[model samples]
Target: MQFLEASREQGIVTVTLSRGKVNALNESVIDEMTACIRDLAVDPAVRAVILTGQGKFFTYGFDIPEFLEYGKEDFLRYLTKFTNFYGALFLYPKPVVAALNGHTMAGGCMIAIACDYRIMVTGKARISLNEINFGSSLFAGSVEIMKMWLGQKNAEIAVYTGALYSAEEALGLGLIHEVAAEEDLVPRARRIAEEFAAKDGAAFGSIKKLLRGPLAERIRERERASLLEFVDIWYSEKTWNLLKEKQIRS
Candidate 1:
C-alpha cells in the first residue's frame, strides 16, 4: 500500500504507517489500511498483526490540513471511509497490537486503542484524543472504543479535557498495556505478537468475537447514522474559525 509498510515473517505481519512525517490518517490512508487488515484477518499464514508508525510519531492523527480543504460532500465521504476502517480494525479477527513509538493524538489515539494491546515507547512523547481542543467531535464508534479501554469516567475525561499524557501517565490510566524504551518497543511488540500467534487461530478469533462483538456492533450502528452529522460539524463555520485561530496562534 502507498501509505503503509507491510511485511510478514513467521506468521506475523507488521504494518507501519508511512504516509508523511507523522503518518497522519486521510481518506486514502484509511482505505489502504482497512483493506490490508481485512486481508490479513482472513489469511491463513497471518497469525498476528502489529500496527505502528514509521518515524517519530505513532501518528499525529487525522489530516487536519486536508480536512480544511474538504467541502461538505467530500468531508462526508471521508468520514464514512474512516468509520468503515475503524469498524474493520476494531473487530479484526486476528490479534492486533499497537507499537506506539511516539506521539499519538486524536484519530491516532483511536486506532491505537482498537488494537488488542498497546505497547508505548518511553520518552517525551505523549498520547491523547485532543479533538475537543480544536472544537472537533469524535466519531461515535471512537467514543465506544475509548470507553472500552479507559472505562466511562477516564474516557470522558481524556476526550473532553484534550490533555496529553506522558507514557507513564497513560499507563496509569490504563490507556496502554506496557511501556518500553524506544529501542525495545518493536521487539517487545513482536514478542507479544508471537505469544498471541501461538493460540489456536480459529478458537482465538471466535472468542475475541464473542468478547468484543457487542461493542463493535454498537459502534457500527452508531456510525451508520452519525457519520454524516460528524462531517457536517467538521465543516461548520464554528470549527473552521476555531481551526483558523489555532493556526494563527501557532
Candidate 2:
C-alpha cells in the first residue's frame, strides 16, 4: 500500500504507517489501514496486530492542509470513514497494540486510544487530543473510546485543555499503557502482543466483544450527529484560518 507497510511473523501482523516522515492520515491512508485491519480480522493465522509509524511521528493526525482543499460534503464523508475506522479498531476482536514511535496528536491519539494496549516511546514523543487548541472538535465515538481508556474526568481534561503530554505524563494520565526507550518500543510492543496471542483466539474474541460491544453500538448511534458538528467546526472561519497555517513537515 502507498501509505503503509504490512509484514507478518509468528502469527502477528505489524502494520507501519509509511506516509512521509510524520505519517499524516489522509483519506487514502485511512482506507488502506481499514482494509488491512479487516483482512487481519478474518485471517486465522493472524493472532495479533501491532500498529506503529516510522520516523519521528506515530502520526501528526489528520492532514489538515490536504483536507482544507476538500469541499464540506467531501470532508464530511472522509470524517465519517475516519470515525468508522477507529470504531472498528476499538472493537477489533484480536489484541491490537499501538507502538507509538513518536508524536501522536489529534486524530492520531484517537487511533492509539482505540488499541487494546499502547506503548509509546520515551523522550521527545508527545501525545494529545489537541484539536480544541486549533478550534476543532472531536467526534462522540472518539470521546467514548477515550472515556473507556481514561475515565470520564481524565477524558474531560484531555479534551478540554488540549495539553500535550510527554510519554511519562501520558502514562500518569493513563493515556498510554507503557513507555519504552526508542530502541525498545516495537520490541516491547511485540512481547505484549505475543502474550496476548498465546491466549485462545475464540475465547479472547468473545470476551472482547462482550466487553466492548455495548460502547461500540453507542458509538455507531451517536457518531453521525457528532461528525456533522465536527465538520461544521472544521470548516468554520476560525478553524479554517488555523488549519491554513498548519504544516506537515517531513
Candidate 3:
C-alpha cells in the first residue's frame, strides 16, 4: 500500500491514491490499485468503496517520462497492466465512487469513468481525456467506459478535442454526478456511498453486471489487437520525435 491508503468506516472503504504531488499512474500504482479493487470487491463487510486522491491532484494521468523510455514490449506490458486494472474496476461487484479533488486527465479520466459515481470538487482544476494530444491511442476498455459515462457523442468530442472542463462544465457534459467545494469532495462521496451501500449487494451487483457486461466483453474481445496497434503507433519514429521535442522543451 505504498502508493495507496485504505480505511474503513460504517461499512464503506475509502482508498486514496497517495502518490507524490501529481499522483501519476505508473506500473506500481496501477498494480496496487488493481489489487485493491479485487480485494474490496469480495469483502462481505464492505458495502461500498470510495476511490480518491490525496492533496491537490486526483491524478495527472500516466507517467509520461516513464512511458517515453519504454520499448515496445515494455510498453505493451504496461498497457496490459493499465487495461486490466480498468476491467477490474469496471466489473467490480460492489459500488465504487470517485472523488476528484483536483485535475483528472488522460488515464485519470479513464479511472474516474469506471466508477459507479463521480463527484468532483469545484476549483481551478480541470478534467480531460488528453490522449490525442499525447499522440497515443485510447484502449478499448477505456473508450467503452468513457462512452458509458459520457454517451458516444460527448466521448468522441472529448477525445478528439482534448478539452479540459471545469467542474460545472463536466457536470453539464455528464462527466461527473456532482460537484462540491474541495473540503466537501470526500464527504460528499462518502454520503453517496452510504446511500448506495443500503442496497442489497447481490441485487445491486447483478444489475450492474447486466448493464455493463456487454461493454466489458466488447472491451475484452478487442483488447489484444488494440494494445498491439497502440504500441506500434506509440513507438513510431514520428511519435518518438514528438516526445523528444516535448521532453527537451520541458
Native-referenced Cα lDDT, model 2: 0.92
Task: Name the regions of candidate 1 deviating beyond 4 angstroms.
Answer: 245-250
What stretches of model 3 exceed 4 Å from their correct place?
245-250
lDDT of 1 at 135: 82
User: What clash count does candidate 3 reach?
Assistant: 0
**Cα deviation of 56 in candidate 1 (Å)?**
0.9
Q: What is the lDDT of residue 45 in candidate 1?
A: 94
Error (Å) of candidate 1 at residue 176 is 0.6
Against the true structure, candidate 1 has what lDDT? 0.87
lDDT of 1 by residue, 172-198 (tens): 999999999999999999999999999
User: Better model by lDDT, 1 or 2?
Assistant: 2
Q: TM-score for each prediction?
A: 0.95, 0.98, 0.95
Q: Candidate 3: which pairs clash?
A: none
Best by TM-score: 2
Expressed as tens digits, the lDDT of each residue in 186-249 for candidate 2 is 9999999999999999999899999999999988898999988988898889998888777565
Which model is ahead, 1 or 2, in terms of TM-score? Answer: 2
C-alpha RMSD for every candidate: 2.0, 1.0, 1.9
